[model samples]
Target: MVTGALAAAGFAAGALLPPRPAFASEQLTIISWGGGYQDVQLRKSFFEPFTKATGIKITEDQWNGEVSKVRAMVQTNTVNWDVLDVGVGIGELCSHGLVETLNWNRLGLDRTKFLGDDKTLDCGVPHHASSTVIAYDRTKLKNGPKTIADFFDLQKFPGKRAMQKGPTSNLEWALVADGVLIKDVYKVLATPAGVDRAFKKLDTIKKDVIWWTAGTQPAQLLGNGQVVMSTAWSGSINNAVKESGLPLEIMWDAQMLSLDFWVIPKGARHLDEAYKFLAFGGSPKPQADMTRYGNNGPANKDAMALVDPTIGPNLTTSPAHMANSLEFDYSFWGDKRDELNQRFTAWVVQQ
Candidate 1:
């Protein structure tokens, strides 16, 4: 009955798909960035429910968002991963045909219902929107920094700070901190001068910055008082606060919002099962249920309405939170990632 209801809603492609033999015992392999976020937000919300609903077993795996591994699998004709949860590299993946071109009709998803520009996403369906925001331990600092610029101001908030060890959000935050408006972030980043400006601003806090590679590091750093401020994924911080009772608070100003997508490897062996799960995962209720475990916003337009009112205001897409946010430009990064990543790496090693 529930599955039928999902199909009626026009996004439940799994229920609409032809049924598989009950005894076939086929299992779908899914790979994602594993941590508390995947364990709770995705596993609880989609994986377990998807398995129960479809009766198709799922074997989950973890990846660090390596596009090259996906490329190698497709190129070598050893595509083992059926569904992938990818971030930041969808453009290159689609352009290179590393992933399958989605059939919205087959999936039964309404393009209008999903967030993000259709032109920007062609190979995958966005499941949730998460943000990287500057977070501080409120218990430690009575008057915490409130803006992206404050994160870079060592004099005012004199202490070591944490930032992801990458060019993506760090570059954008630096640009915003240096006085670029939120909407013009990508525009300013498109030129050499703008890139230099971001790096120059980063230079201001270079010595005092502690770079983090793991998603859990920021919240952990804040909890341990290793750093007073850090740019962290919203879900990670929220999970920390909820589970550990940390007094962490996020600075929503200039939060960098990014979407995580469900993509199929170009030649997934379990194509049918992948599509079934993809469609089921895109449904509004599952997307909204994701937020019950963490703060990531659902991608389905209607899912926002379904989200618990208590959780809605804390989401990255919330009107109050979005008033000063910046959407991460995957397209721009698609073109400049390699170039800027190398530059960022070289800069990080310098004095």
Candidate 2:
């Protein structure tokens, strides 16, 4: 997910949640990117089970990873959202004091058992790791695309291509498709010439590209033949293939792996209850349970062993998938996103 502030014009669009007491409350509100990702993976495993055990009814809300909404809530002291599922901009959120600095002892989970690096775990608990992989419907393309380069080769695999409307994985993938080795993607991307090269490659497909913002659109686009192939979230592709019986297949090469985190907005009313829910959801058991419903890998290290073997190969953490994967450089993006976002938008407007 692209992490940053979004305009909070629709902040009051959802159910108006009643504020909870810090010590005890019957209700605790948590927000995540809603859809099958939340409905199946989170609702079944975390929300429902946590409520059953603790009797804290969860008021679930959905957003598209809008850090600005959280920022607005914190600034106004109307923090109804207790726990947030954030991506990419966590360090900025922590530095700006938009979210609380988590007390690890309060959760009592083993810090070392978490899967992400130290920088990621500093302010928020790791929720799950998902990847942006090249996906296509096998039934449409009998001889399917096999690599990132194929996704760009209009002469060989000609059709409308779908990708999210941003410069996240798209920029990195453009470089890889243009022949930049995965190991040096960030190193090269840091240079001006490399950025121009990535844009130059994207220019080839700009006319053929179909931009999608919602997570659900990619699989739908592929399944319904709106496009021959797309850059889609692995969990969405997994759900379409497993549950909906879509003939979607994923190309894990050059996959951009990203982590989602559980954060508490600074003024969150239900601090105590929030910590309790975080601890329960962050444990090996609940973390592992997420895999039963989607392709995301468990963020708890011990939970990896507990993932059902049947679905293990489909997960981002699977050794086969990780062999050629590129970890999304949060630090680099945190520094460069705004500049690139502007550049990408300006480029998109050209004929």
Candidate 3:
């Protein structure tokens, strides 16, 4: 239900999609980060068009991004979701054989140059891309933050701040603000002292931080003047600005780019139909549609050509912004999530 409320955004499909079919197939319940991000964005860009094209009635459900919930369904052989649009844990689940094996060729995808090295795992089709970046009210901070270090420089950029209530991107930003190179974030985080150092940096502004859990909260917090700046998902803040006329601007410096994937759980009831949907969604046109309608970048690099040039400036992978960005180290999180989360949890409760 958290995913449901967190995603308050918009949706629309592309005119580029081919004509829809007169008929539809059996229904499938796809799980994803819900609310408008799923209900509006994917439904318009991919699902509705997919149903029209192949006659597959796609129903969507929200999941809390917990691997254990997915594991429970897999182990009990009660997998209801046909396709899962999941985040960072795909690598860990794939390693444990919890997700179905992906067939790159069958999915109508090549080695995706979209993600630099095509971070395509064997168990998932990489879909849309997003990033954790600093967003500030241009009206509030006339000359705003342009880098992660600016986020920590309270003296120069003084304002109450809103940050996600988790250590994932926060730790990375902490280190970067402490003068760690973008490329060296995860490497430094892998060590005990590295983590301590990140937390120590965070302590500098701990009292000033307004912790947010839902994705929508950061945007809402900023729009309502609860905080002048926040680290927010690209899609969430952009959608809020477009919808509510919030005078927000995203600072792309050292943005951590990440991609979500569509995966079939091992015991999916609509196995074959699900695979068809997976392939359909990954096609270039729909990926472009998603970018056009939402804040995410396309997982397929070729999609850039199809998307209107107007939105290019806001994209995470745009030529202008990509230079200063760093791709998130999913493997680092996959290997160290438990250990790191424990420390992060204890730190949060202390003050």
How many clashing residue pairs, candidate 2? 0
Model 2 residue runs over 4 Å out of place are 1-27, 55-57, 89-91, 224-226
Best by TM-score: 1
Tens-place lDDT per residue, model 1, 81-184, is 99999988887787778899889999998888877766555788899999999999999999999888899898899999999998999999899899988889
lDDT of each residue in 108-181, candidate 2, tens digit only: 98889876667667678987889999999888898988889999999999989999999999999999999999
For candidate 3, give the lDDT of residue 150. Answer: 87
Regions of candidate 1 where Cα sits further than 4 Å from its true position: 1-27
After superposing candidate 3 on the true structure, give the runs of residues whose Cα lies further than 4 Å from its correct spot: 1-27, 116-120
Select the stronger candidate by TM-score from 2 and 3: 3
Please write out the lDDT profile of model 3 over residues 96-149, one tens digit for every residue. 788888777776677554473333467777778899889998998899987889
**What's the CA error at residue 169 for candidate 2, in Å?**
0.7
User: lDDT, candidate 1, residue 246?
Assistant: 91
Q: Best candidate per lDDT, number?
A: 1
lDDT accuracy of residue 123 in candidate 1: 82
What is the lDDT ranking, best to worst?
1, 2, 3
RMSD of each: 6.1, 7.4, 6.6
